[model samples]
Target: EAKASYWRQLAMDEIRRRSEYQPNTRRARNIIFFLGDGMGISTVTAGRIYRGQRRDGSSGEEGCLSWDRFPHVSLHKTYGLDAQTSDSANTATAYLCGVKANVKTIGVDSRIKAGQCHTDKSTHVSSIMAWAQTEGLWTGLVTTTSVTHASPAGTYAHVGHRGWEGYVPNNCMVNDTKDSARQLVEESPGNEFRVILGGGRMNFINNTENDEEGLKGNRRDGRNLIEQWMKSKEGKSNASYIWSKEQLLSVDPSTTNYLLGLLGSTRLPFVMEQDKNCSSYPTLREMTEVAIKILQRGPKGFVLFVEGGLIDYAHHANRAAFALEETVGMDDAVISAMKLVDTKESLILVSADHSHAFTIGGKPERGKDILGIGGYSTDGYPITTLSYANGPGYNETKVNYTDAETTDPNFVQKATFRRYLATHGGEDIATYAIGPWSHLFSGVQDQTYIPYAISYAACFGQFAGSNCHTCKTSTG
Candidate 1:
């Protein structure tokens, strides 16, 4: 028992050291912005509740960290400039660029093109990534989605249209020379982002050759971007680009000055799929850990953006189980990150671009047979099996449906659920932040306040103020 106690104490000390809040030792230079891509307040709440219920047959709140624990918290109005309901492109531009843009815009502002009515180009703008690059800080981007997707694009590229993925529609742009998607992935050189890991092999490769394997397309650019990145080293710096899990783990972290790992052809496989094939694929947490290790080499501190990009896709598909699992997976990444950097100098901000149409309301007992048929109250009442507001797979049924064949026959059929409500919640979504000046987020504020809050708190951002300034400057 004494020996066991000593070892346990040593382990606890090590964990505490990893998760320490060392403000003074911190460089006050590095920033990590983690985005849970379509994770609305409800999704988070449900995820927490589901995980909690699974653990102890209690509300999800019991099993996880609450966003309220952050020193600062704020809300953002997620509507696009042109539309009330916003997409990732518009929202990412707002949060990343500090400008509210029209729907489908990446990192550009709205300025009508000369002599062209209804046509415009975004004015001078720079993403936090670009700013960090200019500041000579090591930068990196990690995501579970295609790196060229809208959310990640906001970090590196600026384009008028979001869907300019290599192939451009005729009416979109005049230049047929440059592929927007390719530019989005490779343009980060100006920022000197040492590590770029995610999906979207198609964006990097040419439209002439087939990708590695499991994908059907000629997307390999004749010039390998990985090799180019490796060769463009400064002084003794070197880079190693890996596409497979085996390659990623085998690379020498001490020798590799820069690392580019693009695991999948598009967005990575969902968490469940990855878990089943864990031996061959790195999980999101693993990717984040490796990126952090590589980026920490720069003494000026670093800027890293790690995204749980698949949560949005799962929510869009109305796959609540998959979405919740993804959220948990994202949480694991966050936990891993927290173990890496001290809370004082490093700023960790976790937020979502917008809310989802998801909800959580039912009297279902904890662990009370998720796959079972609904039952009536002893006082004589009807119960719901599953519920949704609006989506393609909803079927209105007066009777309970429990059989595997009736409940979910196929992927498309599995999406269908009974309606318990007709509307989404009007409540604001939640934001979480810690480290450095995380005290800036405490109460409710607009979505626009998020970027400024993080920037001002971190002592960065050329453009500060609007809602965050009001919160930080005001005493109330």
Candidate 2:
């Protein structure tokens, strides 16, 4: 219980803070889009509370996340053009390309269908990264998931199927369509990128080849695309390719204009599972800051896409602790970006592709351990505060976690129904923004509005207006 003075003072402080806040009116020269895959409003609330508890053992419910200070906030519908509940591919296409696409499709419009091998090339859609690059702006991407994964793939790859990342079917897709990794190496926006940092190097190397870690490659096309990417940069720019954390930090951002960092064979290990082997893996914060340091050198500024993609993975696996930690990890990158960039000249947008069936309920008291049990069930079994709608944790009988180590990374929370993996939730996601034109993001808008609003602020795509900089319009 709190007193009247406490409530009044808290309200006054918040009101005073709001009154003093003023948005920057100038058009943004730099655009940084941060995507937290599967991070819904529930995830945000849990992560904020979890972070607060971890930081100071506070009640956590009243605390704010790093991005909570952003002056503009909104809610957006997350359904795809063809899906009542969307996956990463379609949702990424919506936010990144400003087009609602079918599930399992990336960088293409509704004219493309899932698993369709061949389609008219005109159906291909371009993302903000392309629009920025065509305007002579530096472009880059960073993520904790595979660079070939659906979220990042939307920025570069135009494939009928996201699984085409490493292997294009031998079927009749016009016989010469390259895989996603090859596109990143040899094609448009991806090739023109100033920085590329993420996992999935197995897709880049030949099946016969091995990386420095002795991990076998997955590419059956016999192309070492990493080497090809390096060769393509020959005599064009001071490009450097790295496969380890030490290599990433050793390269000087002042001299290296193009950087490709493949940090993991697949997705990077979860934070809790990371072996103090800092030399092997790089945090999302490290990759983002490094990318910003190099990309910020451009005279015309830059557009960067940074993703905390593993949150979705953890949620599907029914690991609530890891999901919440990954959410906070994204906020860590946001905090770093806020410190590194000039908000007056940079527009920072933080949002999610969709949500999970994860929930945080049960009248757990204030300061209760977020990962611990909430209360006992009527049957006399203790249940955790966190649970899922459907996942591997489901059983005919509820399992008791009363004496279990709920904090363990391997611990899976209970679910109401059985599913090998949980599915995405069909719900609106919260969107946060700041910098110029961020107010346009207020209120409920379609997910496709993300790139549109960004384009308006950065002066690219269809919103470039009459005095456009590019000879040809890249997108709108």
Candidate 3:
């Protein structure tokens, strides 16, 4: 009787939600495209359950993520130009630049090959960020990874290899290509960013300067790109460079039109490892909040990209707990952004570049602890709720884990095969969206369709001559 009533309530809730849904066709005044790198379907399920379990001792199957409630959702094909499985650089290029490119390549079309610098000379494909800037919209990028990393670099840098953050790959087929940092800072100073915040301070500063965390610099060249960036913006805009949480919090968003914040030398601390009591770095939520405040000051509205890059990092390391923590951290940022923006004039998208080969199965009963080990296998060995197809945690000897610890933050779930790092899954990933033509995201779509959807909703490129002006006036 109770189960029936519970299911009935859920059905009624969904129906009410659909009944209240209104499709907004207005041209978006702003757009916030949030990418959760390597956040697969299984990852989302586990993260949702983990988030619910952490809140209270209950079966987390009933819990819903912030984006899960989004008005429209669709699965996205993550294949690249050269392979079924995709890397971040290629996948980012497809969605951000609106075209598919070879693996490990950024901001270029399929004609360019990875590691071929000379071939990329005239193949630079502009991303939506550039389009937004040209359309008089402010642009910004926020990520837990380095700003010059594959995902964020797709927005501006036209590098052949994703590894060329501060140095070129020795095996590169060409030599004249500059590193990603050089492209971001030296090549295009600030690149019209209203707010830029994330890690990878070493990529900008020189070897003589120690990062805020006392980490040694990795820049091969003696140039201090951070100093150059500051000098270029000294008399032009209200620019500020911040490296610590104190500095970030002290900035007045109203007066500051341009801001650059580097939270770590490489990647910021994982949410699970962060010192919530006295942390030097700000949380992803805090970063997003500050970014929106600064970007919102623009008269033409803004387009911001926030990435949960550490989720992919944790999955590569086979740390399920850490990955789920990062996903939840991303959800918090989405919630924060929701409160700060109006749904009528803004478009918000949450998507993943690709997926990890992580799995969440064991078939535990309802309300079971998401991170706990489930019942013993037929061989009398306990199995965890989370596992991988291949990873360093593979149990080659078939050891029994009836009493083994599986709930630690650093615990790596058992895998089927041995690998130093778990591989990415070729499976389809999800895209969730709301506001301004979000209804177009209802069916399975190619990865390239993402940028098209955003462009169509915001009236960019071919859609610039669209009926947006009339639609906006009518909607308003």
Candidate 4:
């Protein structure tokens, strides 16, 4: 009963705090959108436990991650125009471009189908980045995936096929349209971005050319886009192009007006796989800090999109440990931004494109390692606390437990199906918000409601005409 007073007092304080709460209605001068790719509610819950365990070696069930502390939260359905479950491509169109497109399409309306090429600009739907620029707000994007990947590409590219990032195959023939790499370097909002960071250098360079690490690119077109991006920024801006961790962190945001860092040839290595002391790429948190430092220098304010894209990649491989770790890494980035930006006039949004077919079942007890075995199957064989609904892990029937290393990083949790890769889940995802207009984020919403809500919060797009003249900024 000694702890009852402590819990009661905490509850009373929280009640008092909520009872006197006033929503911040001030015009948002800055907006930061954080997308945790394929981060479902399950991922967040498990990630919270994993984070607490890793940090304090405790039971890790009671604590919350950084964004979990946000004042407003909502659950949003994540379905594409054609598919019940969504991929990053189509969903990116909704969340970033504010329009739902067909599966595997990006930045175009539902008129564009996946794997098809179109020459029409009429079907194109512009992203918030473009809208932010229309109002002269500085814009940028950072991701663990290549900057040209689905979510980032949604901010700029209007391609019909997501796989056409590097090259357009003969059958898929993207000859009529620009590939995502070309779009980033040659397009309007993309070329004007002050900061761009991530992997997938192969899509930006010629197949004959080698990246900084001697990795050959995959682009059949002989054009070297990285050099072209540099040339575009020459004299016009104090642009810094870097390809290593040391170079990225060394960049002085005060001196550099434009930044581009392609740290990997494809998607970045999963966080757990990177050597902390010698890895050449910065963590998502490090990239976020540098991006913010540079982006916040705008006179008209800025909007930045930082994506933890590798979380999806880890889940697809049925690596629950890595997926949860990536989520925690993203939480670190969110925590860093919270300290760097003033929440009174700045709006920070955290959301996901979709979810993976993963589960955290088996009813393990308190303080147990999240990745450890939770219970035994009907046959008396051990099963893990984390397993996918479907994945490559079901290649064989299980009869062993004594020789198993359930906690190993390479451990692929069991799956029900024998697919080559896991699939996305057809379920609702959550969005958490803080700062200006954050209260509007509560309740169930469609996935496309995200960009519109952000626009409303920041007073851009249709809401640019919005005024907060009577609203006073909160000091507390």
lDDT of each: 0.66, 0.88, 0.85, 0.89
TM-score of each: 0.79, 0.95, 0.94, 0.95
Candidate 3, 210-258: lDDT as tens digits = 8767877777667787887788687776889999999989999888988
Model 2 per-residue lDDT tens digits across residues 1-476: 37999999988998998899776656689999999999998899999999988775788888888888888999999898788999999998999999999999999888889888764779899999898886779999999999999999989989988898888888844668777898898899899999999999899998899997899999987889999999999997789989898888888888889999999999998887787555378989999999999999999889999999999999999999899889888889999999999988899999999999989987688888788888888998887888899998887876666635776668888899999999999899988998888888899999998998888788887757464333345676
Could you tell me the TM-score of candidate 3?
0.94
358-445 per-residue lDDT for model 1 (tens digits) = 6554466654433233455465544433334555546554444444533331222222344432222334656787776675666777
Candidate 3 positional error at 96, Å: 0.4
Error of 2 at 207 (Å): 0.8
For candidate 2, the 10 contiguous residues with the lowest summed lDDT are 465-474
Residue pairs in collision within model 2: 461-475, 462-476
- Clash totals in order: 16, 2, 1, 0
Q: Give the TM-score of candidate 2.
A: 0.95
Error of 4 at 348 (Å): 0.9
The TM-score between candidate 1 and the true structure equals 0.79
Predicted candidate 4 versus true structure: per-residue lDDT over 10-110, tens digit per residue: 89998998889899987789999999999999999999999999986778898899998888999888888899998999999988888878899999888
